[model samples]
Every structure is written in structure tokens, then in C-alpha cells.
Target: MKAVMVSAFGGPEVLAVVDLPDPHPAAGQVSITTEAIGVGGLDSLIRSGALANHGAAPGRILGSEVAGTVTEVGEGVDTAWAGRRVWALTGESGGYTEQAVVSAETLVPLPADLSAVDAVTLGSSAMVAHFALRHAHFARGESVLVRGAAGGIGVIAVQLAARAGAGAVAVTTSSAERGARLRKLGATHVLDRAGRGAQDAPAGYDVILDIVAGADLPSFFARLEPNGRMVAVGVMAGTPPADFGMEMVAAFRKSMSFATFSADTVPALEQRAATAELFTAASRGELVAVVHEELPLEQAVVAHQKMEAGEVFGRIVLTPSRR
Candidate 1:
């Protein structure tokens, strides 16, 4: 089998495709013949050594999500899963290969109408957006501001919020073109990356889905209305300063709240349900899975480079040669 691995922790150049012996699933696991692999910011962070302390190291495969067909199932797994089309979570690694082994429980049967590219694009990102909005207690008719809303999860969050009857769906994106695209996807207002247009919402936002958390996090937090809730789902700009929370405390009189959410904490059954719902919505044309582009699996390095450079507007999927 051929796989892309982090030969060293550095830039995108460190990702090298190499040949390896084929892997077979163990007990309770299944092996997938990958059709498409999703690439995201976390993969870049791991490749750059930013997550080394978290067990990301040299020689590690650099992918977490994939969409493909099951070729083999291990002990304790159902034979029915073999030859079934599915999208799966490959934990922290092992997805950047022609064949990936993952626990059977992690597989979500792909909708018949969904393409492999769209499956990988919306697979985990839609789940995160769904749960993150729930964490923020988002309600219909409430205003929502999706920070860093041009990325995969952010794009899904925007549409989901709008579809749920949000009174306002505002987004912070890099350019007018990207913002225009978002507007068509249900964003009511488009702000620059610095959140310039947010001032138009005089009462502030009722819910803020922040995918970018860093020095500018406080600025967005301040935009929340009284009794507003802000859910941090990603730290694309890097972690915020330690004292950033003091601002939230200072605004106690507003009764505002801040929280961080990750799909990892969600129960497997709930996650699976959400995944199925998202896929169904997509297949029904109720949700759009934005894919910026698709590259051959061997070009994994180029995929990371585009993602890290902020050149990608949505998800970038890698298609294995077999696909």
C-alpha cells in the first residue's frame, strides 16, 4: 500500500508518499479502500510539529477522515459491512493512505447519492458544526455570527444556522468574493476577516460560532449581545492569550457566556446520528458540501500547502489513484 507520512515535522514538504505493506483490520475494526481523504488545518498543524507533544511525530500518517468502501472486516465486525460504502473517522492518523483501518463503530454508511468528494468534505465538519451550534444553544430566529466562516466547518455552520431559521447569519471571511459565495449559501451579512461588518448588527449577535480563536478572540467576544453565547470550535489563528477570558468576566453584567466545543466529546451514537442526518440533508439538496478542489492522493503535500496558505475556500479532498 502507498501512504503519505510526515517524514519529518516541518512544512508541507515534510509530507512524503511512500510504499508500505498492506494493513489488515484487527478485532472490531474494518479496512477501507479509501476513495477520498479530507484535508484540514489540523493536518497542517501536525505536519508543522505544533502538535508534537500531543503524540504527532515523525513518520506519522497525516489524516483523520476518509470516505471509501469497506474491503475487509475484522473479528467481531459484521460481514455486511464489507463492500459497503462508508465514511469513517480514522482517529488521529492512518487516513492518508490507499487503505485505512478503523474501528467498525466509527463507520457511517454513506448516502447513495453522495459522491466520495462530498462525503469526505462534509463528514466530520458537519458533525462539528451541528454539535457546536447545539453547545451554543442556538435557537431559531436568533442571530448567528460564524467566525472564520469560509473553511469547511465554517461553511457548513453558516448553512446549518440559516436552515435552522436563524434571524441573521453573518460571516467573517477573507474577501468580497468569498463573502459573496457565503451569502448565496445563506449568510445574511459578510464581514472581513477582522470582523469589520459586525458593527451593523447593533444589538450584537445572539450566538457566535467562532472557528478562529487567538489574539482577536476578545474582539468577537465583545460583539456578543446581552445573554449571548459564544462557542469556540477551532483555533485556526492559534490559541488565545491566557488572560483572554478576563474580558468575558468583565462583561458579566451582560450575562454573556463562552465555551469551547469539539466533536470528540460527543457520544458515538449521537455523532453517527448527526452524520447520517447531515448526509441525508446533503443528498436531499437541503445542505451544500463546499469542496474547493480535489487533488490526487500523491499530491498530499500540495493540499496541505494550499490549506495553510489560506488559499482554499472550503474543503480540499485527496483522491486515491484507485478511485
Candidate 2:
């Protein structure tokens, strides 16, 4: 099997496609022949040495989400899943290759209307969005603010909230053009990051799905309703500031809850079920993965470059160029 492997941490240049042994499933596991690979910010972090100590890199396969067909089954696995289309979030890294193994429990069947490309594109982002929104216990007629609303997770979050009966969904993006596009994707309010208008998001939101961190925190925390909740999914803008104490205290006093989500930790059953719901929504034209581009797996370096440069407006998926 050919895969993107990283032996050292540095940059996108570190990811090299090379032949590697195919992974065989252990007991209770299944082997999937990769069809589409999801490229994300975490992949970049792992390649750049940021996640080196996190136990995911160095002489390891580099991918977290995959959509593929079952080619083989291990002991204790149900034979029914063989040849079925599925996607999964692997706890350990190995989604970039031609074939990868995962516990049968992690597999989620792809819907008839959804393609392998779409499944991989949404990957864990949609799952995380669902968990965050559901965990926040949002009610009908409430409003929420979302940062990075044009990105993979934000787009899904906006649609989910809208369908769940939000009074309004306010979203912000660094690119004015992308912000404009988000409006058509169900965003009720689109703020331009170029003009510092994100500062006003606190005024109208009862909850916030934060994908970016740093100075944006102060502005975002101030926008939440008295009992509003904030789910922190990423720190695209960098880490929090030194004086982040105010927001922490505000959250404590107002009974606000701050949380983070990782699909890697999601239960296999829940991942499959949530992914099925998301795919159903996509099939009905309710939720769609805003795919900005598709590149060959060998060009993963270029994909990471685009993501890190903030040039991509939505999810980018990689496909194996060879069988």
C-alpha cells in the first residue's frame, strides 16, 4: 500500500507518499480500502512538530478520517459489513493509505445519496459540530454565533442550528467573500472580519461555537447570553491571551460552559449514527460539505499549504490516484 508517511515534524514538505505494508485488522477489526481522505488542520499540526508529543506522528501513517469499502474482516467482525461503504474516525493515524485497519465498531455506513468524497470531506467536523450543539442543550428560538462559519465544521454547525430552530445564526469569516457565501448556506448574519465587526457578535448571540481562539475570545465571551454556552473546537488564531481571566470568570458567574470536542474520542456507535444523520441531511439538500477543492493524495503537501495559508474556504479532500 502507498501512504503519506512522516518520520519527522517540520512542515508540509515532511509528508511523503511511499509504499508501506497494508494494515490488517486484529480481532474485532476491519480493513478498508481507502477511497477518499480528509485533510484538516490537525494534520498540519502533526506534520509541523506541534503534535509530535501527542503520540500521533513520527514514522506513522498520517490521516484521521477516511471513507472506503470493506475489503476484509477480522475475527469477531460481522461478515455483513464486507463490501459496504463506510467512513470512520480512527483513534490512531492511518487514513491516508490505500488500505487501513480499524475496529469494526468505528465504521459508519455511507448513505446512498452521499458519495465517498462528501463523507470524507465532512469527516469528524460534522460529528464534532453535532456533539457540541447537542451537548450545549440548545433550545428552539435561541440564537448562536459561530466563528469560522465558512469552514468545514462551521458550515455544518450553521445548518444544524438553523434546522434545530434557532432564531438566528450569526457567523464570521476572515474572508468577506466567504462570509457572503455563508449567507446562502443558511447563515442569518455574516460579519466581515476585515472591519472588526465581530466585536458585536456578543450582542445578539445566546450561544457561540468558537473555532478560533486568541483575542477573539474576549469579544466572543462578551456576546453570550447570561446562560450561554461556548464550545471551543480549535485555536486557528493562536492560543488564548494572558488576560483571558475575565471570560473565565464571566462564564463561571453566568453559568456558561466552555468545552472542546474531538471526534477521535467519540464512541463508534455515536459516530456512525451522527454521520448517518448528517448524510441524510446532505441527501435531502439540507446539510452540504462545502468542498473548495480536491487534490490527489500525493499532493497533500499542497493541500496543507492552502489550509495553513487560510486560502481555502471549505473542506479539501484527497483521493488516492492509484488503486
Best by lDDT: 1
Q: For each candidate in the order shown, give its overall lDDT on alpha carbons.
A: 0.91, 0.80
Number of the top TM-score candidate: 1
Model 1 Cα lDDT, one tens digit per residue, 271-294:
999999999999999999999999
Q: Number of clashes in model 2?
A: 1
Error of 2 at 76 (Å): 1.2
Position 15, candidate 2: lDDT: 82
Q: Which window of 10 residues has the lowest lDDT sum in candidate 1?
A: 194-203
Candidate 2 lDDT score at position 208? 85
Candidate 2, 1-323: lDDT as tens digits: 88888868887788888887777888888998888888877777777877767786688888888888999999999999999999876658577888888878878888887888899877688888898887777778889888878777888888889888888889888776787788787777778652255544436467788888777687677667778887788777767788877658855867766777666576678778888888887878888787889888888889988988888877889898653
Lowest summed-lDDT stretch of 10 residues in model 2?
193-202
Which runs of model 2 end up more than 4 angstroms from their true locations?
Answer: 198-202, 250-253
Q: What TM-score would each prediction reach against the true structure?
A: 0.98, 0.93
What's model 2's overall lDDT? 0.80
Cα misplacement distance, residue 275 of candidate 1 (Å): 0.2
